[model samples]
Target chain A: MTQLREPLSLISECGLPAALEVMGERWSFLILRAAFNGFVHFEDFSSELGIARNILSNRLARLVDHGVLARERCEHDKRKVEYRMTDKGRELLPAILALRDWGLRHSDSAAPNLVLVDARDGKPIAPITIRAHDDRVLEWGDLAWAEPGDVATAPAEACAEEA
Target chain B: MTQLREPLSLISECGLPAALEVMGERWSFLILRAAFNGFVHFEDFSSELGIARNILSNRLARLVDHGVLARERCEHDKRKVEYRMTDKGRELLPAILALRDWGLRHSDSAAPNLVLVDARDGKPIAPITIRAHDDRVLEWGDLAWAEPGDVATAPAEACAEEA
Candidate 1:
């Protein structure tokens, strides 16, 4: 796992933009969603997503280049290739799930068809949330941008007052 | 807060795709990111995002139509309309934040400009994670898909063993 490295400034960074640059296309997110559900071969992705062969090929290549997916030649067939999700790719589960959760709640569709379960307990996972270190769920009103230096541990009141 | 609703089947659901249909455009995600940072007016979004007027206008309208944004006349200036996030729009914050977090960890860029902080405690919020009901962080290996009826509360082993 990568270590947390919070930026000193929050006004101008393009973290989300950067991620979007890699995976922003309409088909890319869908492809990742399929990958998470154990879709690996090109045919499987294309059939499941109904994506064009050429576009699917291009998107898969881009995903591989970005290190989100690994393209490996099929051992049984030299001409065939399989795309596997990397650990980095797996980390995207929450983002996709978040989008799915938002859709289920707000979309006009009354019935959804997917369920993400905890293999440990067989219970369904919850929508991803922005939580404090102590694990309290946060909402939009609870968030504010702050400079790295402004986050001083010396006085909790100092920070609370800024709110 | 919405309750968790497990899907009956994962293969046939359009949850993620439906969400993408509303927000799949390249610039929609950026607009939502800016909204989270408190940008509301058309000019503010256009200037800050450097988006073309026609394209920005279209996106704003589409977002409004999708009920993600509420366009209301400014109280003081009837000629000016302010785009405010609806509850649906606010729900997308976690998704955007998840993309930002992934970008921060895996993007080629070494510096991220924005940091999401909890105003209540002045502490930075941790990366969003898919947690179980008992609060254990899960990875791809720790998850499995099952039918709604397959999930039982009696014993977790029944589920783990299925894995």
Candidate 2:
């Protein structure tokens, strides 16, 4: 963890750079948001997001190419195509929610007119969080990078020594 | 909630568009990641991220202008400067970590060489999750949008009726 404090050239080793490479742009994320909100048809995405045809087309194609979305023939209308979210795309929910929550809390826009609520109870959902395996909340200082092979050989003692 | 299923202009009403306006680009996020990894000096960011000096300067200035980072003179060396994370920047940890976790899991790259561990127990942290206020793990289907003013007038019956 702290080892990264030095210029070790390990930045590329993390998955972040790769993830950003795929969905780092604004419209891409907005398109993903639309997908999560149940947008599938090209026209739906274009009209609802109010995104330009070329931009929406590019982002959707990129998402499908990357496997985040799958292109499928609409069962109800074989002549029509739909962009469906793959499992990989669905799994990005937490990340999207985290950013949405951050934006809701910190943006200069007028207070959000809507809130994400739990369907069962109707209460607004709690903010997205990083929790330990045992369900304890964690802070930035509570994190460290495990040494190589340490996770397999001695997970418990890995960050202990550093701490 | 499900009302978004129709063509509504509410997409811009969510905080997501605002958030994307601020930090939706790849380099901005990468720079933030480097800062979280304890990089303070411009040279450290440029050398470690292999970012161009002009690009680094531009990103740093934008982050500062947005109040995500504060530029300060290094106390120990007046001529030297440090870019420190503001509270706003620190709050993005969950979003960043969530994206990092997604990348680690879905990217076509090789398995991650390092794991993020909890400093207290040295165990890998759990995946970021969306939890209900009552601590229940929630799926995407469990979420709905609260009607405007419903959060204040009838929080419990809002999504319940929709459900």
- Fnat of each prediction, in sequence: 0.65, 0.66
Cα RMSD of all models vs. native, in order, equals 7.6, 7.3
DockQ of each: 0.40, 0.42
**How would you encode candidate 2's per-residue C-alpha lDDT over B1-163 as one tens digit per residue?**
0111323475437677656766875478889988988889998888888778998898899889888999999989897889989989988999999898888778677767778878888877777888876656788788888865675344453334222
- Model 1 agreement with the true structure over A27-81: per-residue lDDT tens digits: 8998898888788899888777777899999999999988999999999998888
Structure candidate 1, residue pairs in collision: A10-B114, A13-B113, A113-B9
lDDT of 1 at A31: 87
Looking at model 1, give its docking quality level.
Answer: acceptable
Model 2, TM vs. native: 0.84
TM-score of chain A of each: 0.83, 0.79
User: Highest TM-score: which candidate?
Assistant: 1
Model 2 C-alpha lDDT per residue in residues A13-116, reported as the tens digit of each score: 77776678678754788788888878889988888877789988888888898899999998888988899889888888999889988887786667666788
